[model samples]
Target: MIYFVNILPQSNGDHVIHTENCAHLPNMRQRTILGYFKTSMEAIEVAKKNYAKCNGCRDCSEAIYNNYN
Candidate 1:
């Protein structure tokens, strides 16, 4: 299953709302956010914005993997 893990923060909280089945992948279960956006373009934008502020390599990899895979 493909998961759209939102790495961007929302106005309501610091969490990234994710899409369904985002956690289905064994490696992605621990991911913070996975949300289904209206379009892939939007998802990519959010991912890029979030990746830029990542503090760890794992986070950067995870976000990239989630967006591409």
Candidate 2:
């Protein structure tokens, strides 16, 4: 699946990663494409290289969000 990371930081300073189909996925102007990934973890790992405090969107990447959020 395709994934993306929000360009804006969360209130707690995390940059949220979301699946393309996520309910809360940000608009193109507000996010950075993370590329096609087999799993949310893969996208999250890529997001982490650029954003130290990256977490997954709870609605679409629940397993990832649960681990970090």
Candidate 3:
């Protein structure tokens, strides 16, 4: 399966990352594309390097937690 992540730039200059299917994702007009990966973990890894986790996305947060723990 393919995995994807989005990088959202905040007004304060911080960034947030969300899974492609994240329910909290911004509207299409406000969304930004980071890139796609072969695995969720891969996408998460890249996101971790540049952005903070989005607490609004439970699936994305759980995936990261499960993968690391």
Candidate 4:
């Protein structure tokens, strides 16, 4: 899947990682392309390279979000 990371941080200070087609995905100007990956884990790991706190999208990557929580 093609993933993206929100440039804007959430109130909890997490930059959410999302699948390309996620309903909750941030607008283009507010997100950065995170490359293609088979799993959300790969996308989250990539986001973590720059952001200190990253979480998978609740709507698209529920499994990853659950693991992080």
The most accurate candidate by lDDT is 4
Error of 3 at 21 (Å): 3.2
Clash pairs for candidate 2: none
The residue pairs that clash in candidate 1, if any, are 5-33, 5-34, 18-34, 18-35, 19-34, 19-35
Residues 1-69 of candidate 4 have per-residue lDDT tens digits of: 999999999999999999989999999899999999999998888898999888888899887885763
RMSD (CA, Å), each prediction? 8.8, 1.2, 4.8, 1.2
Expressed as tens digits, the lDDT of each residue in 1-69 for candidate 3 is 333344455555434445576766667665556577665566566666655543223455455543432
lDDT rank order? 4, 2, 3, 1
Q: Pick out the ten consecutive residues of candidate 4 with the lowest summed lDDT.
A: 60-69
Reference-based TM-score, model 1: 0.33
Clashing pairs in 4: none
Instruction: Report the C-alpha lDDT of model 1 over 8-56, residue by residue, as the tens digit.
Output: 4435333333444433323454464434565444555565565542221
Runs in model 1 with CA error above 4 Å?
A: 1-3, 6-19, 22-29, 34-36, 52-69
Enumerate residue pairs that collide in model 3. none
lDDT of 2 by residue, 1-69 (tens): 999999899898999999888889988899999999998888888998898898888898877995864
Candidate 3, which segments miss by more than 4 Å at Cα? 1-16, 28-31, 52-56, 65-69
Alpha carbon lDDT at 50, candidate 3:
54
Q: List candidate 2 segments past 4 Å from native.
A: none
